[model samples]
Target: MLFSLITMAIVGKLLHNKGYEIEKLIPFVLIAGLVAYFIPIGAIIIWPFKVLFGIIGGILGFVGGIFGSTIGGIGGITGGVVGGIGGLIGGVLSVVFGIIGVILGIIGIAIGLAFGLVGLVLGLVFLFFIPATILFVVIKVLHSETKIAPDRR
Candidate 1:
């Protein structure tokens, strides 16, 4: 299960980077991961590796963004990369928070852990990684606005 979740996360992310934008599938992946975590189907220790990879990906993206910005006349190049990193962060955060939320939620049910539930939901949203979708849309709008549209007349 752990292996599958990790693979799905990586593959989905790659697809997203390649313009597929498969944000809708994140929640399913995350819920699967959470269930797998409890069922002991995967190495719980592997969780840290997720965070590590996310950090590495983010750093690589930041460097890429730097180069892109320098080469491009405007921030157009970097913004997408930065936004992609942001989306990656969101995915990573979802995994991290989901793990925490599940653990605490199960343990805190008796105590009514609203915080845990809230965190879990927020994590779900992040895991879906919707920000990149929105960011790209915004970037497109801005890019179009900056362009001198040919007059219809």
Candidate 2:
């Protein structure tokens, strides 16, 4: 599953760098990942190389991004090389960050749920006492005319 996700991300990035819209390809990638999951033999075969190649790919991609950015400054082939490497790095980082975000989101939900009743009670108090009272005061102030004492200069 990890291998497939990583591979799909890499492929998606590569294609995106080539100017293909990744959104359109997401379904296909998902389908491919599903197909890959069903095939255990392939996963077993790629497991050993997955880590080794991922590191190598990342190192090479970093070098390529630097090189491409330098060349990209001049225009032309820069887009292809630089974009691909940038996309490669971006894809991997996105997946990593996405996972982290999900984890944090889960933890956040648990925390929020734990304190939910407290929050609701506090919110009701504020709503009824603070904002509602403030709004009433504001409306009264706005609508009521102030009586000024006659000037007795």
Candidate 3:
């Protein structure tokens, strides 16, 4: 799990530096790692390496997002099942509501993805603007040279 998280973070940073927006991939990688950890199938052989590949693959352009989204869909299914089971208590209505909650959670996740994309764009814009503003102020101050000077020559 720790390795998976670290790998995802590194890949995410690398992809971001390479002009790729792969923020959506993180959750997918996380889910895959969790499944690998829990499931005793042949995942033992492929899981670690797949995790590595996923991390690296997701560091690029739309590719990472695509892979991540795919994995995330799988994860969503598992999550829905787990969430529904966990919430299945307190009567029949609770189970029904739990199913509804699971569906809502999936919808919420989709909404979050949209918001994440928007936030990424806004954050990039802010990154450029904030630095430019700071630089402009610094340049103006330097040009004016209005600060008090030292007494020494």
Among these predictions, the greatest lDDT belongs to: 2
Candidate 3 lDDT by residue in tens digits, 1-153: 555555556666666677765566666556655654566446576899999988787677577688889999999999999888777654678778989999999999999999999999899879998889999998998898677477757
Task: Residues 4-97, candidate 2: write the lDDT tens digits.
Answer: 7866777677777788786777876787677666767566888889989999999999999999987877686667788999999999999999
| Model 1 per-residue lDDT tens digits across residues 1-153 | 556677567656765776664566677556756765566644566778988999999999999988887888456657888899999999999999999999998878855677778888889778765787788788898878577568855
Query: What is the full ranking by TM-score, best candidate first?
Result: 2, 3, 1
Q: Of the candidates numbered 1 and 2, which has the greater TM-score value? A: 2
lDDT of each: 0.76, 0.83, 0.77
Highest-scoring model, TM-score? 2
- Candidate with the larger lDDT of 2 and 3: 2
Stronger candidate by TM-score (1 vs 3): 3
Q: Which stretches of candidate 3 lie over 4 Å from their true place?
A: 1-90, 129-153
Every model's TM-score: 0.24, 0.28, 0.26
Clashing pairs in 1: none
Sliding window of 10 residues with minimal summed lDDT for model 3: 32-41
